[model samples]
Structures are given as C-alpha cells and as structure tokens.
Target: MDSLHHDLTVVEQIEVSPPHATIGCKSLPLTFSDIAWFAFPDPVHTLFFYDHPITQTIFIETIVPTLKQSLSITLQHFFPFVGKLAIFPTSTRIPEIRYVEGDSVAVTFAESDLDFNYITGNHPRECHKFYHLIPLLGSTTKVSDYITIPVFAVQVTLFPNHGIFIGMTNHHNLCDASTRFCFLKAWTSIAQSGGSDEPFLANGTLPIYDRLLKYPKIDESFVKNANVETFDEEYKLPRLSGPTNEVRATFILTRTKINGLKKLVSTQLPTLAYVSSFTVACAYIWSCATKVEKDELAAFIFVIDGRSRLDPPIPAAYLGNCVMPCFTLARTTILKSKEGFVTAAKLIGQNLHKMLSDKDGIVKDIGSFEE
Candidate 1:
C-alpha cells in the first residue's frame, strides 16, 4: 500500500451555481482581519472520507446527483463560497469577494483505484498520494484595474466497494474555520434531506455579513503589508506540487488521555493562569517536535477566535476570519528539561491568559503584530 501508484480517472467536471435566478449580485468587503491573510499564499485544503460500500454505477447514478443538487442548494445560502476574490491595484481600495448572477463553483467527479483504507489510515503516507483527490481552483483573471481569483472548488472521488472521498479547496481570504464548519453543517443537513434546504433554513444559523468589525487604521496597515499596489496580471495563488519526501499522519488524543494531560499540568503548576486540554496538547506537541540545542529559543504560536473579544462582540456566524495569534517563546533548555511538558504548558497558558486579558482589548495593538 505504501508503494501504491496514483490511479485516478476523471468522470466529469461540472459547474454548480445557486438555483437559477434565486439571488442577485452580492459582494463582501475584506475586513482588516481578512486583509491580514491577503499575503498568505497557501489555500485551505480538506479531505473527508466516508465508509460506504457502493459500486461505481450506483455512485454515478445516485450519489453524484444528490451531492451536486445539495451543494447547489447550499451555495444559495452561502454564496461567498461561489464568489471570486477581487483585488484592486491600490491599497486605498479594499479587496472583496464578488458574486455575480452566474458565478458558479467548479465541482469535479472522479474515480480512484487507490486503496481507501490505506489512504485513510493513521500511519504516515506519502502526501502526494492524496493530491489527485484535491480539486484546483480556477485560474485568475484580470479585468480592468482589479484581478478576480476563483475562491472555492470541490472534488468527489469514488473508491468502488470501499468508500467515497470529498475534497475541498478554498481561498483563506473568504472565511475562517468556524464559518467553513457552518457552511458544511448547512450542506450536510440539506444533503440529508434529499437536496431540500427548507430544514436548513428553518434550523441552521444564517451567516451574518454586516461588516460588524471596523478598524480603518488596522485595515490600512494590513493592506500596506500585503503590498496590493504591486499586484499585476502575473499574480497567482501558490500551489502544491507532488513527488516529495513529505509524509502526513494523524494523531488523535482520546478524552481520557487529554484529561490526564490536563490533570498533570494542573498538579505541576497549581498557580498557572490557564490549564486545559488544548493548552496541554499543544505544549506536549511543541516539546516533542522541538529538537533544538539546549540554549536555543523555541516559539509556539496559535490563533484564538476573537468573535467574542470584540467591543460589540461579532456574531458567532460572522463570515470571515476573526482570529488573533498568541505567541509563546522560551529557551529550548527549559522545554527539553525533565519537566519539559509542564514548562511548555506553563509558557503557553500564561501567554494565552495575557492575550485574553489584555487591558486595552484584543484589537488595540493590531499593528504590533507586524513588529
């Protein structure tokens, strides 16, 4: 299985839009938070595997249509997923996601001969083996002074008699993890109801697009950092290439294990400002991953959701990035000591506490991030 070659056959490429004439042109401006990611070259890619034995004929006849129709319905409510990221040549004008009447998402249906269990297993596997299942976003197009970049794409791969794989690629400027999760929830609900969005409409929380966050100076700073003025027709999103030594594996911590780690941190550092499963997990991973010399500096950084940290507190369903990074730096000697895990946990916990309890608020020192 480790030596398995990539064997994928393209079934069809289809364009799916919201049900015809259901909505008009819609545009969403990039907030400072979104603008902060404008320079990030990597797009978010995700693969979902489901165990369901089915023949190729059944997959094409029923599964494909159901997913297609349900996705179309999902896009009607979550139009940003189908929109294009539009960036102008000047910092004075903010970038945006624009959805015209006929804008559609590229959805590819394919069949793969690769072993499903091997690819989905917990063991480390060649990263390129899964690359074929990930769909590529459409090429960028420039019109007038602004360039329009396709933001989202989907791929469905069928492994006959094994299972199905759903892969997605989306530009980070469009939204964050929470918003993406909400979109999936709506799509899954509609899918479960046979392509009807009525249930999702009645039960799910609609995305809030009211630009509730405003910090003009911060926006300007991020735009300047992104250097949008230099973007030209040759600009393109960075892409992933194959045939490398890179391997990816998944590591899961059960609830009991996480609890044990938490208890250990609490017992070791009784006065630590914060101690939780997430903090301990991060600390443990950091300590294990760092192999630097005793005196070298090591840093651990992660993002915190800022939806509730805002002055007015943006809605939980806000449709774009609302996260702030927390940085913890310490000498490798401390992290590699006998109490390495506990030391790492204390460093991360104290930094998290400081960020969450900042006297001036989370958005106060936005410019300091670049420093």
Candidate 2:
C-alpha cells in the first residue's frame, strides 16, 4: 500500500474565466479586515471520506451550474471578503484570486478499489496532507461581492493495499474554520438538493465590519497576555513559562457524567458556572498532567464571534475571519477544590459571558486600549 500511495496522482484543473490583459499590478496592502483574518490560527486543510463516490465528471457537471447560480446571487447580496494576497498579478484588485496558466484545482471521485483508510490513527497523518497557497485563494469575483475559492480533493493509497481514499484542501483565504465547515456542509446540502435553496447564509444577518470596528479597536492591550509573535516564531516554541511541548488529550463526557458534575457542584459552597465545561475540563486535565495543586493560575483563551453584536449588517458569509477572543482565569486552588472541574467551568463561563456582554467587556476594553 505504501508504494500504491505514491502511485495515486492528483489531477488538477482550474474552473475560471479569462485572465487580465496584463500581469503584475502594484502590491495591494492588507486592510484591517484582511489582517484580522490572518491573525487567526492559519486554517488547517482537512481530509475526510464520503460514503459514496460521485465521479469527478458527474460532480463537475452537477456542481458547476449550481455554483454559477449561487455565486451570482451571492455577489449581488453579500460582498464577501476573500482577502488580497493570493490574487493574480498585484493584490489590490477587487477580486483576490485568479487562475493563470499552469495552475489547476484538484477534484476527486470515490473509487472502491482505492484504499479509503488513509486515515492514520485517531488523527490523519500530517505528512499525508497537502499544503498549497491558492494564488487567488480568496480573490473576490470580478463581478462584485462574489468570490470563487478553489477547493481540492485527492485520492490516497496507504501501504500496498488498494482501496479508494479521498482528500480535500482549500486555501484559508476564502473561509475561516467555521466558514469552511459551513461551506462544506452547505455544499453537501446543495449537492443533495441539486442547488435548490442553498443554505449558505448564517442564521442571523452578518454584521458590517466597517462600522463595528468602532467598538473593538486594536492595540497593545488588545494583544494577548500570552507571548505574542509571528506564527513562524511560535512554531515548536514553548509557552512563556511552560514546557517545550504541548500535548492534546481528549475525553468524552457522557450525559450521566454531566449530571453527576451538576450534582457535585450543587453540594459545593460557591456557585460553579455551568458554562465552563470545556474550559474547566482543560484546567483539570492540565493540573493532573503537572501533578500540581489546583490553585495555580491558568488562562482559558477562546473566540467569540461578534456577528450578532455589530450595530450594522455585514455579509455574514463573507469569506474571511471575524472572531475575537475572551480570556478566562482560574486558580490552581480552584482546580484542587472538590468540584474543581465544575468550579473552573463556572468561572470560565462567567468570564466568557462578561467578556461578551459586560458593559466594560473585552471589546470595550480593547477599544479603550486602542485609544
């Protein structure tokens, strides 16, 4: 199967219109919004499987028409922000990405004979993933508010075994992690619906970033208390006061266990926050790992999407990042407490809620800091 792996060829082609008359325009500077998207953890490309095979021909035939219709409608209604870096020639163009010669987008069809079990262990092998920057990864459509993002999928063969395997990749420019998932699910639904009533819009109206910027300003105070550096500088780098390596561990919490936690917290003195389950879980796990008492200081940093909080509507589905962080604090003593997990969760929840809606919340704090 290992040799078969290399045998799998990734067929690529771009679906786009004619190129610009000339090449190499001036370099486009990134806007505040553009930098906002870049600030997020660089999006990771994912590999997953489909229960059935839709031949690339069939998929292309089926998907293109629907996409054309949807893209037309989307551009008219929601001006998506695909960012500027990957646009063909110079970056300042209204549309961010374009297909020039020799560039191809990859698509796939499921094959039963190919190995589908390319999945290695609980997580897919990092080496198996493909990393490429879509030159127009997020270029908006030349036709206003719309943008065409290139998504790629490949089949893989692991070991000498021959069974069908599929892999998909997309440049992060067009969608944040959440938007990526939204697009995938939306694509599947649209495909299933034959493009009827595409469910691409977020439930609520998207907030307008231009106006919302007034509330949350950027500054040193907006910077994370944790060490700040370019992602390249942070790679394999230890946390400011922590070890060289950070390990990810997972656990499943059953409803029964959740009830037990609730019961335990009710019996404890301070009211534990019901909101911090995941945050508290992290604290507990970390505390156990270090074999230290619970009272030590730990921070829970997480994102809060501000779409609904904005004063005006922005294209909710615009293809870029629009997330802010909320940091929670927990003491080691709280973790060692009898209801440590629940306690941490409660405190985390409180802080998270306060960060989002408190009169003097993080947004306001950041705004003042920027001033």
Candidate 3:
C-alpha cells in the first residue's frame, strides 16, 4: 500500500478541451529529457487540498464551473498534455507526444465522506487516505511493460463541510517540477481572473517550447538501464495502490535545532568547508538513516539543477526537464562514525561544489536512477 484507502466515488468525468486549438498539433517531438523516462512505470499522482468553508450547493453550482473553464484555458497553452506518447518501432527518431483536435483532459468530480481534517492534519495520519484522492494514469506489472494512457488528469473531491480537494496526475515524461508548478500557477491565475485565456502575457511565465536547449539525442545509458529486462505485453496491477502497515508523520526542526546541527558539524571537523544549513541538515539526516556496519558502502544521491550549467546556459523559464543526479559514495561504518555527520556535510559540500567547478565530469557520470 502506498497510502490509506478511503471511500471516494466519482460523480462526473468532464472532458476539458483547450479553449483555443493548439496550432500544428498532429505530433510533437519529445526532448531527450522526456525520452529518458519512457521505460519507467506510469507516472505518479500528486494532490492538493483547499480549505473553503462553503456550502455544497454553492460549491457544486459556482466553483465547479469556474474550475472547468479555467482548466480549459490553462490547457490551451499546454496542449501536449491532452495527447498520448507514441513510440515508433521502425523509426530511428525518438518518441513523440501526439494529439488530435478531439483530445481533451479528463477531470473527474468526486465526493468523499472521509474526514478532511484527519487526512490534512499536521500531525500523523493514515497514509492510505491518499489513495482515493488523485486519479491515476494507468498501471503495469512487469519491469519493462507500461500502460501509457492519459497524459494529465484532475479531481475535485468535495468534503461536505470543510473544503475542496484539487488533485492532479501528470505523466512524468511531459513535465518536470519547474514546468508542473508553472502550469498550476497559470491555472490559478486564470481562475482568479474570471477564467479567461486571453492576454496570455498576464501569466508572465509562459513555458518555452524550444527544443534547442536539450541534448541532440537521448542518452543511450538511460534506455539500457531501463531494459535490462524485456517489455511485457500484459498488465497486472490497478492504477494506484497504497503502501500497507506504515504510519506517516511530519517532523519540523526548529531554528534552534538547525543552529545546533550546524554547531555540531563545525565541532566535528574544523576543516569541513562551506557548511550551510542544507549541508548540515542533509548530513544529520544521512547519518541517522544509514544503519549498516563499518565496512559497507553507502551512497548519497543528489539531483542537481542543470539550467545555468549548460554551455550557453539554458533560460530559467525554458520548459521540459533539465536536471541530473550525482552520487557521493562512502563507507557505511565511516558515515555512522562520530565524525559521520561532519563527513556527510563535507561530502554534500564537495558534490555541490563540483556542480559549479567541475561540470563536465559530473555530466559524463550521469546515470539513470532505478529503484
């Protein structure tokens, strides 16, 4: 189980079309960043909830209609999301994100009897409660096989007395963290402005569709790592499932604790350089998480933002994925030692420093992340 299951039923499935048809929408090529994730299982779902103390009649009558329109307008600018990914067997060209005039985003309207506060509390709650909120794209069983269904989906689950839930599921190949957030901000801005798609400049941060910033070709290592096995033609699992028997909790480290951690790092090693809050925090957590004995090896994997590191430097507003993961390897015993925290801090500092100073080496060592 990934989260605690709850009773969530769909009332309606709305096909949200782009307010304006996307020009030249037959096929859109995937960037190298996009191609890199082709072999992974269907992308995961994410959810957000809003606390609006409004009556059910008013919510169903007013907010639902506004959301649909705003979403349609948002999709006008992000038409690729309405389509599905295409992989041609004989063609040497990379996969494409294809769409037709009739393509639309699936937005489902749902209502939940589940306690809103129980799921949304800052204190620990059942992780299973999340299973029913977000819509899933599809599911797969074998390591190589996947079900590529819808590219994007949304759910509006009403909580009778508390608030509205805005849940979303996005295909990973299409957007990264930066792109996802921009799309969301666009939706909110339009909805707030009476659900209009006109004067797109008002959104300020439109996504750049330029493919020039991406690598000319897909990195071979990415695919090889994914297909160590073969693709299965069959499907097995349901779209989304919850993790079993696990308690979920959130921990907040106060400023006093953060300062104390920094002090500890300094005391552990005077030579530890560039010890920032992130370094100390990561180091402290890393030391605590690793339980292996002295001789085993442990790796700290960090994903670095690659926007400004490119040759000419890619624009911050440029869309698609532009990030790479770098790993720091050390002995588990050494990491768990009295100097473990300082060593971890130094290790993180070393990798971050390399990101700025030794860009080429890091780029060459880029390997796909597999779990």
Candidate 4:
C-alpha cells in the first residue's frame, strides 16, 4: 500500500487563538536542554490517519469547528505558543521564549484524494510518501534569524471517502514528546466533551511551562575537561546528512516475535534477561547495518526521558525538553560476529541500568554531539 504520488490540496489556513484573553508581558527562559536543540529537527511529527465515521457535512460542519475551537481553548492554558523566541547577544542568560497577546497557531485544513488503505496500510511503502501528510514547522522559508521562528504548525488533511489525517509538527525547544502527547490528549478530551470545561485537568493531564522547574542536570565537566569541539565548532560535508538512495521502510514485529528476539538475547547474555523490546530491536538492526571492519566502532546512540530518570524526578506537568542520551559503542567486527546481537544488547541494557540505578545519575557530565 502506497500513496507515493498523491495530490494534497491545502484548502484553508486558520490561526487558532486563545478563546479568552491571554495575559501578556511574560517570558520563559530557555532551559539549557532547550538551547542544545537550536539546530535539530523538532523532535517529532505527530501524525495519525483515522477512518471516516461521519458524513462530509458532519465532518466539515461539526468536526473541524470543534477541533479548532478546542485547540483555541486548549491554548489558553498553553499561552506561551502564541509567543516567540527572544534573544539577546550580550546577556549571560539564555534567550527567553516569550508569549504575547494576539499570537496565534497556524492550522491548515487540506483535502487529498489518496487511497486511504494504501496510505495507512500495514505494508511496506515509501517513507517519503508520508512526509507530505505532516506539515512543516513554519510556513515561510527558513529564517537565519531565530527570533521569527514558529515553534508549531499543524495540518489536517481529509482522505475523502477513506479517512482523515491530522499531523502536527512541533519544536523540541517548545516541548518534548510527553508534553506533546499530553496536549493532544487534552485537545481530544475537550473535543469529546463538546468543548465544555476541559476534561484533561479533571483527568490530571496538566502541563508545567515554567522553565526553571527542571534545572540542567547535565554535568559540563566533560566539555570543560575534554579538549573537544565546543557547541559552535563543527565540520561540513557540503550536503545534508540523509540517505538519498536507500531502503527506508517501517517494520512492525508481533509480540511473539519480539519475545522470541528478547529470549534469544537473554540466552546469550544472562544479565540482560530483562532487556526491553527497543534494546532488542536496536541490537538486531545495528548488527544487520554494520559491515564489520574489525576496528571500526559503530555507536548506537539513543535518547531517554530524564524526567523520571533523574535522581530527583521532575514534575509530571513540566512541558519542556528533558531528554538525556545513552549510547553503546562496539567494534564493528564484534557487532558482525555471531554474538553481535547479544553484545549490542548488553551495552544498551547496561546503559539503562545505569540510567535507572546509578546514584550519581546517567545524565551527569555531557558534551555537544555536533558534527
């Protein structure tokens, strides 16, 4: 199933502002965690394709307006989005992300004639095909000046007669996956209530926007002690880093198969009997992707939420970035060997153990990963 060549027609662009007057003259400082993501892609593209259960009239007359209204009401609590990044060069402090009145979020309503099953099927399809369904972070061309950047953009495309797709592109500096998920859940909850008092707060789905709540736990000793490139120094390859030619497709393994993989890893490494499905999958994929040069090191780097992993857990309502990195470096030759999968799995398991059990913290001492 594939919609490799589907037509996407953007019908309307609406700015959903807060339902009530938002208090202005407020600014939230960018946490150290947020500043590090200045150059990275907004962590995720939240996309989902849902089957059409209502007639076009109901969808257009009832669904769209409700969603837009709910979004506006939701923004009342998350008013910072109506804000923009405020930067000062001479200040020792981090730039502030500010919110102002009349600021609005852009939502595009679109239509597509693409085959619903083909576009949302469980079969292998071109990864690029799904790119269009998700809207870009900002509507205008890339701005060298960071002050004017839009932290969020949303797209809603209806696959007429098939299903409807809603995609939101969010900035990492604004919020992480957990926060985004909470916002989405809140929006739906409000919509489900026919736009009454938000059901999220009643259900305990709240977001903490104060940046100072989650202090930077990353130890800077690594950057200060090690003679490494600072955040600004880096090499260029003349072109962006991406596979211009390669097989990039999604894979879904059933629970039984996942259990089988975990069992296989555990059989080889007794200590990693509780390795997660993600660790197992990464181990398998890394082993398959390596060419094994005996000396070359292949690093499997992944991120974990630091909210709960930190020594003193952060508030559940905190909405900004709090991700920490955990990595495993293995000799290409070892990864290509018969015990390759187990070797990689053990490294990941060890990292997780440290992240969870280490008293000092797995997020201590960090350096830039810029290339």
Judged by TM-score, which candidate is best?
1
Tens-place lDDT digits, model 4, residues 1-371:
22423477766678888864656566777766666665564435778878885556666787789888888888777765656555442234355666777777888877777677877777766665667777765532222433345577788887766779998876666877777777777778888888764466788556776654434333132222222122211211121223235334567878998899899877778766448998888888888778535568778888888887654467766877778777888888898888887887888888778876766555443322221
Report the C-alpha lDDT of model 3 over 20-66, residue by residue, as the tens digit.
Answer: 65544666666656666665556647778888877778877988899
Q: Which order, best to worst by lDDT?
A: 1, 3, 4, 2
Q: How accurate is candidate 2 locally (lDDT)?
A: 0.41
lDDT score, candidate 3? 0.69
- List the candidates' TM-scores in order: 0.94, 0.54, 0.83, 0.82
Q: Order the candidates by TM-score, highest first.
A: 1, 3, 4, 2
lDDT score for candidate 1 against the true structure? 0.87
Winner of 2 and 4 under lDDT: 4
Model 2 residue 88 lDDT score: 26
Put down candidate 2 lDDT per residue, 1-371, tens digits, no spaces: 11212334333332322122222222222233334443443434455533444555544455444544433233222223211233222222322333333233333332223333433334433332322211112222332333233332223222222222334444444445665555555545444555443454543333232323433334222232212222221132111222234432336667776566556555662554343445445545544543465446876676766554433434555445556667766676666666566556566667776766666664453344455
Clash pairs, model 1 backbone: none
| Candidate 1 lDDT over residue span 50-95, tens digit each | 9999999999999999999999999989888999999898888889
Q: What's the C-alpha lDDT at position 175 in model 4?
A: 75
RMSD to the true structure for each prediction, in A, is 3.2, 9.0, 5.2, 5.9
The CA lDDT of each predicted structure is 0.87, 0.41, 0.69, 0.67
